[model samples]
Target: MQRYKCTISYDGTLFSGYQVQPQKRTVQSEIEEALKKLHKGSPIRITASGRTDAGVHARGQVIHFDSPLHIPEDKWVNALHSLLPDDIAVKKVEKAAPDFHARFDATGKEYRYFVRLSNYKDPFTRHYQFQYGYPLDIKQMKAAADYLVGTHDFTSFCSAKTEVEDRVRTILRVGIEMSREQLMFRFVGDGFLYNMVRILVGTLLETGRGLHQPEDMKTILAGKDRSLAGKTAAAHGLYLWEVFY
Candidate 1:
């Protein structure tokens, strides 16, 4: 069997998420179905680097699966792209070592949350960005973000429903970049719990709005209480920037 590593980009606006769920449309299910069609009668299973929530987007998601077919690695990209939906595109495919597990081998991931701070929302960007009419203190947000960098038990930032026993994760970086109307919060971490990024963004936004102090982030991290953090931001504003091995 040959293991194929596939890099894909998807607009997650319509799908339930990345994982395959019974009776639900998902990126994994769609890709597996297309693979099954390509393989004729054989069953196919794809393993993704991580599961993205509904309405989120991905620019460099990675997955791997084993196939019995003898198709050339160079042809896999074009073949898969032709069969997949327009919203999902196969960026590249190559033969991977058998031991390369997409999830287990992943080293880090980068995510970005976009917010549009303006009086009126742009119709074109409505679906992709979160719109906030009030002005934000970008400097204050950055100050709070600095506290989030490095290793910490991010229990406060993660969703209460997360089943993971360990809440500790290393955040390599937290950066804020602003354009004329867009505010982007970029996070690079070893891994993230469910809704962790969104919650972090929300907390930062609260600080920006003067609802919370910049030093409050230190308290929140130490408290490890979900109630202390701000609300989880909308999923549409989040994007899986990339997955690194």
Candidate 2:
């Protein structure tokens, strides 16, 4: 058997989430179904770099699976493309080391969130961007984001539903960019806890809206209390932008 790595993109609007669930559609279920069909009755399971919640999208999600077939890498992409649903696209396929794991081997990840700046809801982007019409102070947001950089315990930013005990993670960078139509928040980190990115975005947004001072981020981080953070941002606006190996 050989291990193959595939970089994929998906429109998660219709997916229950990335993981398989009983009687519900998911990204993993769809890809595994396609692989099972390709194997002509044999089952194949894929390991993704991480999971995305419902309505969250991905532009560069990575997964790895073991297969006995000898098909060329390009053909693997074509084969999976023909079998997957229209919402999912296999962007690239390549042979990987036998011991390489999509999740455990990942070095870092980048996530991006988009927010609509205007009150006029564009039907075209409703599923892709979070609609937030309130005035936001970009400078204040940036100032608040600065405190998030570097290694720190992020219990305050994580969702209470998360079971992971290690709340410490390193954030390489945090960027806030705005255009006439929308604002984009970018986060590059070693790893993230459940809902960490969404919570971070929500907190920064609150700072931008004058609900909190820019320096309040430091206090929140020190508090390590989830309730001290802002509301969790909508999942639809978030994207798993990339996984760094």
Candidate 3:
């Protein structure tokens, strides 16, 4: 058997989530179904870099699977494209080392969130971007984000439901950029806990509205309390941008 890595993109509007669940339509179920069809009754399991919540999209999601077929790299992409649903597209496929794992081998990830800053909502983008008409102080948000970059315990920014005991993670960078009426928040980190990115975004938005001082982020981090953070941002506005191995 040979291991193959694939890069894919998906629109997450109609699915339950990334992981498979009983009697529920999910991204993993859809892709595994396509693989089952390709193998003509044989089961093939794939491993993804990570899971995304319902309504959270992906532009550069990566996965790896073992296959016995001798198909070329380009043909693998074409074959999967023909089998997958319209919402999911396979962008590229390549042979990977036999022991390489999509999740365990990943070194870092980048996530992006989009917010619409206009009063008039565009029907096409309503499902993709969060609409926030209130004015945001960009400078304040940037200042607050600066406090989050670096290695630290992120218990305050994660969901209470997270089961992992190690809440420490390293954030490489945080970027806030505006283009026209659209605002983009970019985060690159070694890893993230459950709902960490959404919670961080929510807190930054609150800071922009003067709900908290820019330096309050430091206090929230040092306190290590989830309740101290702002509400979780909507999942539809977030995208898994890329995974680095």
Candidate 4:
């Protein structure tokens, strides 16, 4: 059997999420169905670098699967594109080393959350961004973001339903950027627990609004209590920007 790596991009507005769930439309299920049609009765299991939640999008998600078919690397991209839906596309496909595991081999991931701070929301961009009418103090948001850039027990930032044993992870970087009426929070991390990024964004939003102090993050981290953190932001504004190997 030969292993193949596929880079995928999808607009996640309509699907349940990345994982395969019975009776639910999902990105992984859609891709697997297309692969089954191509392979003709053979079952294909695809593993992604990370599983994104419902309503969250991806610009560069990567996955790998083994297949016995002999399709050329270049043809795989077009073939899959023709078979898949318009919202989901195969960016590239190549023969992967036999031992390369998509999830296990990933070194880090980068995510971006978009917020629209304008008086009027754009209908076209509403699906991809969070809209808030208040003017955010960008400098204070940056100061709060600075406190999150290191290894720490992120219990306060994670969802209550997260099943992970360890709550500690390394955040490589966090930045706030503004362009026109849009503001974005970008984060790079070794890995994230469920709703961690969203909660962090929510807490920073509170800080930007002058409701929370920039130093509050330090206390939240030390508390390790979920109740001390902000509400989880909407999933639609979050994107899995890229996965690094």
Candidate 5:
């Protein structure tokens, strides 16, 4: 058997999520089903780097699967792409080391959240961005984001419902940039808890809107209380941009 790692991109619309679920369409299920067809009706399981929530898209999601069939490395990408739906694409595929686990071996990940700053929502970008009609204080949001960079216990930013006990994670950086009519926030971190990026973005938006002061970020981090943070931002605006090994 040979292990193959694939870099994938998928449009999350019209699908449940990345993971498999009973009687529901998903990214993993689609890929696995395609693999089954390639293997002459035999089931082939795949492991992903991580799960993206419903409506959350991915540009560089990674997965690893072991196959008994001996298909050439270069052909794997085209074969999988042909089998996958139009919304899903296997960008690249190569032979992988036997022990190269996608999720466990990941060193970091980057997520991006896009926002549209306008009163009149553009139908073309509606599904891709969050439309918040108002001027955001970009300077203030940057200051608030600065406090979140580095190693810290992120209990306040993480979802309270998560059972993960360790909330300590290292944030490599937080960046914000604006284009034509869109504002983009990029979060690169060693790891993130459930809804962590959305919660952090929501808090920063609150700071930018004058609902909270920038310096309040320090207090929120120190307090480590979930109730003190802002609401969770919508998942539709977020994208799993890339994963770093």
Candidate 6:
């Protein structure tokens, strides 16, 4: 058997999420079903770098799967593409190191969130970005994000549904950029809890809207209470931008 590491891009608008479900379509289920078909009904499972919630997209998501078939790396991509749906595409596939694991060996990840700064939503980007209409103060948001750049217990930013109790994680960077129509929030971190990125963005948005001071981020983090943070931003506006091994 050989392990193949594949990078893929997907539109998650219609899927339940990345994981498999009994009666719902998911990214993993789709890819595994294709693999099983190719393997002549033999079951095949894939391990992804991480899971994305419903309505979240991915630009360069990675996964590794062990296969008994000895297909060429280039042909693997073509074979999978033929059987996969239009929303998901395998970008590249190659034999991976024997010990490599898609999720376990990951060193870092980067997530991006988009919010439009317009009075009305654009037809082309309505599904891709949040339509926040209000003016945002980038300076205040930046100041708030600065406090999130180091290692800390992020209990406040995680979702209540998360079962992981070790809330400490390291954040490498938090940055924001503006275009003609929207604002982009980028987060590079060692790891993130469930809904952490969305919650962090929501908190920063409050600061940008003058509802909270920049220094309030420090207090929020120190409090370690989810209720003290801002609302969880919509999942549709977020993307799994990259993963580092």
Q: Pick the candidate with the highest lDDT.
A: 2
RMSD of each: 0.9, 0.6, 0.7, 0.9, 1.0, 0.9
Q: In model 3, which residue pairs have backbone atoms overlapping below 3 Å? A: none
Q: 51-104 in candidate 6: lDDT tens per residue? A: 998899998899999999999988988899999999999998989988889999
Task: Give candidate 2's error at residue 114 in angstroms.
Answer: 0.6
Task: Give the worst 10-residue stretch by lDDT in candidate 3.
Answer: 126-135
Report how far residue 188 has shifted in candidate 2, in Å: 0.2
TM-score of each: 0.98, 0.99, 0.99, 0.98, 0.97, 0.98
TM-score of 1: 0.98
lDDT of 4 by residue, 91-186 (tens): 989899999999999999999999988778599987799887887899999999999999999999999888898999999999899998888989
Q: How many residue pairs collide in each prediction? A: 0, 0, 0, 0, 0, 0
Tens digits of per-residue lDDT for model 1 on 93-192? 9899999998999999999999999888588987799987777888999999889999999999999899999999999999899999899989999999
Q: Write the per-residue lDDT of candidate 3 for residues 117-194, one digit (tens) a residue.
A: 889869999879988887999999999999999999999999999999999999999999999999999999999999
**Model 5 C-alpha lDDT per residue in residues 111-198, reported as the tens digit of each score:** 9999888999698887788888878899999998998999999999988898999899999999999887788999999999999999
Q: How well does candidate 4 score on lDDT at residue 47? A: 99
Whole-model Cα lDDT of every candidate shown, in order: 0.92, 0.96, 0.95, 0.92, 0.91, 0.93
- In terms of lDDT, model 2 sits at 0.96
- Model 2 RMSD to the real structure? 0.6
Residue 129 displacement (Å), model 5: 0.8
